[model samples]
Target chain A: MTAISGWGRYPINDTEMIHPRTVDAARRATVQANPGIARGNGRAYGDAAVGVRQTIEMAHLNRMRAFDPRTGQLTVEAGLLLTDLIATFLPRGFFPYVVPGTSFITVGGAIAADVHGKNHHCQGGFGQYVENILLVLPTGETIGASREEHPDLFRATIGGMGLTGTILEATIRLRPIETGWIRQRTFVADDLDTTIGALECGDSATYSVAWIDCLARGARLGRSLIFLGEHAALHHLGERHVANRFPLRKPSMSMPVDAPSFVLNRWTAAAFNELYFRAGARKAASSTLVPTHPYFFPLDALGNWNRMYGRRGFVEHQSVLPIKNAQTTLAEMLDRIAKRGESAFLAVLKKLGAGSGSLSFPMPGYTLALDFPIERGLFSVLDELDELVVAAGGRLYLAKDARQSRATFEAGYSDLSFFSEVRRTVDPAGKLKSRLAERLLI
Target chain B: MAAAEKAVLILGGTSDIGRATALAFAQSQWTVRLAGRSLADLQREADDISVRTGRQVTAHPFDVLDTDSFTVFVNALPDLPDVVISVVGLLGEQPRAETDLDHAKEILRTNYEGPALILRVFAEQFLGRGYGSIVGVSSVAGDRGRGSNYFYGSAKAGFSAFLSGLRNRLAINSSIQVMTVKPGFVRTKMAEHRKLPPLITATPAEVGEAILGGLNRRRDVIYVRSIWFFVMLIIRLMPERIFKRLKL
Candidate 1:
């Protein structure tokens, strides 16, 4: 009765039902509907989250089913969110293996994407920590898959994007922590060269990230700010663990509503970027835990911040070029964005290590991702960026791009045929489909 | 208990968040289908999701602008999904929306009319079947309409309120769960070329975890990052005259 979305931020149609609640109920709903798509907190900026006729809401399927403190294993229902997991485990001296940019994603979603984080250089991705999963097949049959048990299904499922089956629950390994804080170091780079030099230096970090501004032209083309961190040792927090343990706090007020346009533009963005670049006064020292939320992901603190981009919405252009062509590849990409006069403020550069996931996006390359508010000529800008990515033998991160040509996608991934071959084993009917699927021609 | 070989749907698909959510489900071995309007882009997203998630992910033609076939779309799926996540959002031109009636209507329709209509159907099926969960990506924007983006924020406010009500409604008689998730700024393809404030900006994965937390506790409302609660609270409590005068 309340309807589906809070704000009509997305273009949605009527004539459909969006279901929300428990797991058994999800099973029952599956039995009745001809087909349905599972929904999490609707944060995905593209159509992968849309439901045509039947949409199942997993926001309430959140439940920590089981946890073994000794081994630091957690069994959570399909809809459990990552933020809640950290709130529960961090004080317990444990955490999820890999995390993405925001905390609004679900456990089912994380497993579905096999998300990677800052530490991915050493830890691989999130899938490595997943012990097993309880799955529901298309025939409405339920099964359990893991590294040892349904090996093929397990591997395919990690990055399959929910086409293989529905995830009922996830069993994952949690990490051990000393204090609820981190020891962090910051490095300021005068150019891209210094940033690259710093990454090659050492791995004595639990986390490392570089912030680059794609807008800087000429002399300071790829100027950067690098930060590295590790968890504070056991003696750091002393006895604060018991007192701060659940950190019971009220949920933040959601975005009251969408904002007016005209708030975001090149001029506004430039001024902000200028201040941001100057604000990162660098230093290295032991830091406070400060609740893993903002530290791990600083952007999650504000709500509906994207509304500033006006009504046309925005898009992020993230491309990872092989390390072999790092300088040339990035230079070209930057040239394209700059020439188009579409430079975003928050451009990041990460020197990737070996990526081990089946369909992982980050490889042994330099990954640069930036957000650009949509405007006239933006599509063409993306088109040009895509071309640059292809020429460098690099690929666009499909997870981030809502507009990608089929040809570009095919060219981006050389082994496109191999994934389809594996998909046939799980879903031969091609029944499970999404808006993203139709575009890619898969 | 084993998870059923599932079919999942994301309403308001075509968003970076929605696509990522679909990818999340797909990688978990769930057969995922991303339904959206632009056939060209959606298909590639689906294929990419398929490769990324390793589930037999596909794309089905969908038009959120068309309100006539929500039921048909749901009925057409090969199988039912265990859950549904709606990351559908439209932060249309706030200036245009505030000044132009049509733009305001578009905002309301995209966030409210469309999602409500589709979700109502989903609710009926989920309730009748006695199962399912609805996770709606409400926003921190919905907390309190501020000076900058109140139009979009109000719609999200309605959405968040609706989700809260849905959660309360499903609490008693149904196994269905409703989660309202609020995320701050996400650095996505759509948000390229913008100056995002540092303290509250989040990446896709951080939001992914917050959504996970809401689901874990079956919480009615989830703030992706805990700090957002304080940020919004201070903003909300401020007097309107003073609030309007502050420079964001």
Candidate 2:
């Protein structure tokens, strides 16, 4: 058995990690391992991809099956990382329709999580672009699923946390871009109300997100810099970027190991947030031409950035509130964190469109994400936050969730029964299992 | 697929190092041909690389131990590649290898005879062409045989010596280059069972980068991570009395 953990590096488990390079090998592994979960790149922040008994590491199975340049549709193995896809296709004028904050995740992980991006307000989640998926059932039977066929299974599989089956491959439609640049504009919001207003006003933008100061209180509560971006066409580029139409980013620095536990304290987080907010505020005056990589995935430049949270690791609390009372709920959420003085160094807010899939996290609402270093009393505070979120008809993102009560999950997702039904249909004996599945009683 | 001006062939193409090196070359716009015992695995790897780089990548079946088929394989290629890399190796269980003649022979032949024989054919072809590069992925274990893995170590030692001899002979032809890469403790399947120190362990991509850099600079011998060179040097310098007393 090997010790493994997701990106958070917390709650590590001892499991046999099997790396099968071919579909046949993977099917054979599933037959041998009675209950296991398929893990892709291990980018999920929690135990969603971890199987205590056996974890099928899909890294070796990555391959491209087919592609149609004319339609920008590509069929790729589930293990293919979004990072590789972007590097390969951005230069060729095509890009994934929905890319999460980090491109390090795998296609399978994205589909399983139904991940949303900065463009959620316009493009929805990644699952919307997937035309079809090939899934290997626990019985080792490979079946094709799409909206037109096996619609229930298809809906259950997306954002199902790998409970239904092992994703073999998927055919996804890619968006075409003229250049690898974003015409970015920033809006500075002074308080919680203004931040919500700015986000609502920027809904027309192709991509939009906000960096809020969770520590800010009173007059500065929820102070944020809203960044709105649109894919820059060739004509929009300046002379300097014209020659190099598509440029892939290389991480300039890396955190080789976890920082000392004392490195990330309340004071340090506040100070960093202060400096970050001020720096972003300075750029609020005029629009800028930024590389798409930095605009979309700024933190990816710092390789292994999760290590910055120190040895105890960190937990991301991402909750989406219904559009009706989202602003008030967000205000209360920020106030709670600010009052505790355990404000996160990285807090993001985005507007989500109507969601698809039975267990998809997004809705026609606002989602707030905050990363807090794991510490004593942290769980109690998060539980309190969850209460407030649930009261406002909100739910937490499963991709980023490390801990949440089963009741909280059910209360948030009303379609849980439908998802469970389809999951049982595909894996009757519950042959496919994960830590997340066990914790959520899915 | 656009026809690349240059082409490179990779032996043992399904191996971690071979796959990584193939990706590095493909990204640099070289048409890639991957040869291994399993055409299925090679075809999958080739397709992946081709998609990632939009370069033509073809898969061919070539058994390293089947010396008689080497000539036929070369003759069957549509075009001769400008560069060739051999990454064949076997890390059979050291304890079993020590006690079993068949196991020991398999390791020796895989690490030494098979790679040497196949590379020899490619070397002769390069010589005839008067311009080609040959890369042999050897191991740091070759520097000094340890009690824990002497069987694989000795085979690598012989392979490294063979590469040195080939480099010496190829020097007469200025255009032909021969490079030997010693990757110490790579995080590939070969070392997956061991607890490799993160500080010293190199990823397959690192080894790939080192090989590409060495090939570009025409370096005759290279350690994937420079620290490995000094580490191996210290090991090679140890007195036999002390080395025998200490277990590696």
lDDT per residue for candidate 2 within A43-71, as digits (tens), equals 88888999858899888777887778899
Provide per-model DockQ scores.
0.02, 0.51
Question: What DockQ score does model 1 reach against the true complex?
Answer: 0.02
Q: Candidate 1, A271: how far from true, in Å?
A: 1.2
Q: What ranges in model 2 sit over 4 Å off? A: A1-16, A19-25, A64-66, A215-222, A250-252, A255-275, A307-311, A335-346, A375-378, B1-3, B119-150, B153-185, B195-248
Docking class of 1: incorrect
Q: Give fnat for candidate 2.
A: 0.56
Candidate 1 lDDT, B1-248, residue by residue in tens: 24337766776456667766775665556677677877655665665455333367666676665779888988886665667777777888888886899989888877777776677778888988888878888888888777678888888888888888877788996789888888888876557668988777888766765665566587877777778889888988999988777866
Which regions in candidate 1 have their CA more than 4 angstroms from the true location? A1-17, A28-36, A237-254, A282-290, B1-248
**What TM-score does each model's chain B reach against the true chain B?**
0.91, 0.96
* lDDT tens digits by residue: candidate 1, A66-134: 667788877777788888777666656777878887777888877766677888777777888899988
Q: Which model scores highest in lDDT?
A: 2
In candidate 2, the residue pairs with backbone N, CA or C atoms under 3 Å apart (3 or more residues apart, or in different chains) clash, namely none
**Model 2, global lDDT:** 0.89
lDDT of each: 0.69, 0.89
